[model samples]
Target chain A: MSHIRIDNLTKVYMGRRSRPRNIHDPEEHFGDNILVLNDITLGFEEGEMVCILGPSGCGKSTLLRIIAGFEPPTNGTVRVGGQVVSAPSDQSIFVFQQGGLFPWMTVYENVGLGLRHIRDAATKHERIQEYVEMVELEAFEDYYPHQLSGGMQRRVELARALAVNPDLLIMDEPFSGLDFLTHMKMREEVVNMHEFLRKTTLVVTHDIDDALIMGDRIVVLSGRPSAVKLMHALNFPRPRDFEKNPGLSRLRSEIFLMLGVPYAV
Target chain B: MKQHNDGEPTMKDNPEQAPDSGNRSLRLGLLSLLVIILLWEVLARGTGWSVHIFPDPLTVVFSFVELLRDGTLLRHTVASLFRVTAGFYLAVCLGVPIGIVLGRSVNARSLFNPIIQFLRPISPLAWIPLAMLWFGIGDPPAIFLIFLASFFPMVVSTTIAVQNINPTYFQVAANFRFSYQETLTRLILPAIIPDVVTALRMTVTIAWLVVVAAEMIAVQSGLGYLILDARNALRMDYVMNGMIVIGVIGLLLDNIMKRLGDVESSKWGIQAR
Candidate 1:
């Protein structure tokens, strides 16, 4: 069943209006503005991992922000589970491109931060430990964000989002900053976590291989003032091994071609 | 992880292996002080300079002992310390919230910015006459001057720190469904803690300066009053003693502030040198 619905959303930013220095000679004013997002509409099913692939300035992040309710659309509406999203909701959590772990907090503290206000302390502690262990950060739980390496901090952020138990997880190029081996490992771990939790996720990225490996369905967006270009459903089974699967490479090539980029191999 | 010794081993050396080196740095520091004292003694006895003009360091030390014995120094030090503490606490209580509000809301900034800017450059010492007229000759006027000195810098620095916080942190807080107050208390305050600590250290120093100046004019009992009294009586030794006491107390307070800043900054993952 579709869990999220985006209906004819539009955003326009009005520039500051200039005034005449001479008050006696006033001229009639016309509205001058920049159109950032044209009308866009899409939907996503529950428990589905959807990748939004687009170019840098394609308004992909803005669209994700609108759905996450960080910013309101100039027109139209975004609904999650039949409720209109006017502001950020606990049901839809956003994972930023940079792991926004609080520098003052240790790995354990950062993961536990959102759950700290819960009246049940024992449950909160257990949940924090479970998520920390799940992310393989048990050894580094006491270390502050700066003390840990970049990849470890990212894992902490992921653990934090997962611990909240949101209905939909929104990721904006979460693994893009990691080194090659770490990136591959992160992809595998994220997929593993998704399968275990069975939570709906929407991922936005520019990497075709990343989309193929992690996405259950891929939505391609065109250039500036982005609109959906194509949607491809993956027929692969759960816990698919990308290294051993030859079909995954073919899908990567198809996505690259669709994005007007030549496939390297 | 490996410890390397490039020079003479000192008190910082590993005590298990180097028992003799453990006290070496302490001994050196003591020896340096003795050398300075001996040089001063030689200059006092040997030079043709007037003994009254630049009294022997021993004379100054003796005057310090005499003031302590008479209990006057203690009373003055306590008075100065009290005024500074009261003023600094007041600044912290009022300045931080105003700063946070201005930093968070554009409307608050627009409303408060002009008034703050107008008052910022007015010297705290210049307020002494007005403070005297309003508060009368006591600790109140002195404290008011100190508060004026410390408040502006603290608020301004805090506002800058809050304004510069990464927006991503706020977004994360909102995604967690945090209320406005929770966001400010949990994320915003913690994020700017290091900067706030720095501002505090700076405020304390400014408060000290202002309090001393205020006490010189508006109050009858303080380190500043002691200096003025000594100058009026033409007892240069007491004046020198008061100045030395002020310098030492200022150093001690600054060190305390430094240690507090280090402790708080380290908690926020900032490495203090």
Candidate 2:
């Protein structure tokens, strides 16, 4: 069994009010089911990093949210470490695209939030310190989220997720709106942290550069009513320069082909 | 000019700006007060107004000095402030937690919204006769009437604030598996503090306003009583003095609340500093 298994997962959001119940079979709506995910099955091996790539509004985030236990699948099962997932647990944490950080909390407080639940006070301070330094926010431990720049806030989110030290880390477009310089720097830090820690990770992003830079394996998802359109194992080494490499260029084109948009560069 | 393009201004970049603005504001306020006083003095003389009807600024000033000398002004002011404080504090204690429930729970909102709407429009002064009958001419009735005046707005503002908080914070709290207490202390409460403080400022003013009216009916030691008593004695100067004192104290109270908001860390965070 894979470390994480999403088996025949299908999600149908009730877009509008349903008709009166007694008139027809309830399953009739299944045909018109605004299917966001369609019987998709995927797996992530332990100690591996996978990036689910697709165009915007392609249900990639919905899939990630489902796997993170934030949403329920209409007809499927998600198994993490051979346990059927029910509710969001401390085993995994989702880092939102917009950095869903607590604005009121100082850096130390936000990073140490997860530890407050488990009541392991002895190592809580030390682990929070370690994660804070890992994300290079040592001097900002007392600052609120609003005081930090966008990039700095996102780093705090990363440190917060890492401080929990979960078996799985899921991120949704973690670098979407960042400037070019900050984007480059953040991607490097993310990959560095992943390499050093080697936790099972899944990232969902539309940006091909982010997928290429951090993904050990990339899964391409199609447009609305999405399914796994393509999956490719990337055998690239650490610090892989996709900007200068022909193989990475070819791989980027492949993703574009899967997304049905032509690769320009 | 150089810092405009960067969009982030530090104290080092704008060394003397804050104090300069504060200084200008103080100068402007003092100038406005002087202009108003001069206008009042001139208008009374120019109109040949009776001193009984419109006490000139000099007469009002003399009345103020007499009140101070007799300790009546201090005692009345303290009594008014105490009533406002008691009522405002009681309103806060009763309103905030209930507001949270009403904001977060549909059932609680359904239960309370109609009752609040009904009680809200009835003026605190309308309760004056009933208050006088029930509490029998003491500080308690005035305080109760002030609390009634303060309660509705505090509840409404706090409920709106809590409801306006982004759903994302709750999701973050859930993501960490936070306990109910943790969610309240760490997430919900902090997010609503700015709104609660703003509500407090509004309610304190309401409480202050109502205490004057309440004191006029049921109490005998506050500025409101002083106004009523002076009017009966036909001491227009003393009545004018009481009005002036109330206005000045209200302004001072507003500034204190403004300072409370200005110095808050949560307030800074809400502005996305």
Question: Please, what is the whole-model Cα lDDT of each candidate in the order they appear?
Answer: 0.84, 0.85
List DockQ for all candidates: 0.63, 0.50
Which residue pairs of candidate 1 clash? none
Off by over 4 Å in 2: A19-33, A117-122, A243-247, B1-17, B268-273
Give candidate 2's chain B TM-score: 0.91
| TM-score per candidate, chains pooled | 0.89, 0.91
**lDDT of candidate 2 over B93-151, digit per residue (tens):** 99998898899999999998999999999999998888888888789899889989988
Docking class of 2: medium
lDDT tens string, model 2, A1-265?
Answer: 7999999999887745555344464333543446688889998889888999987887898898888888888999999999988788778899988849887788989899888855677778888999899888998898888889889999999999988889899988888899999988998888888899999999998888789879998999877778888888888876788676889988888777777778646
Best by the lDDT measure = 2
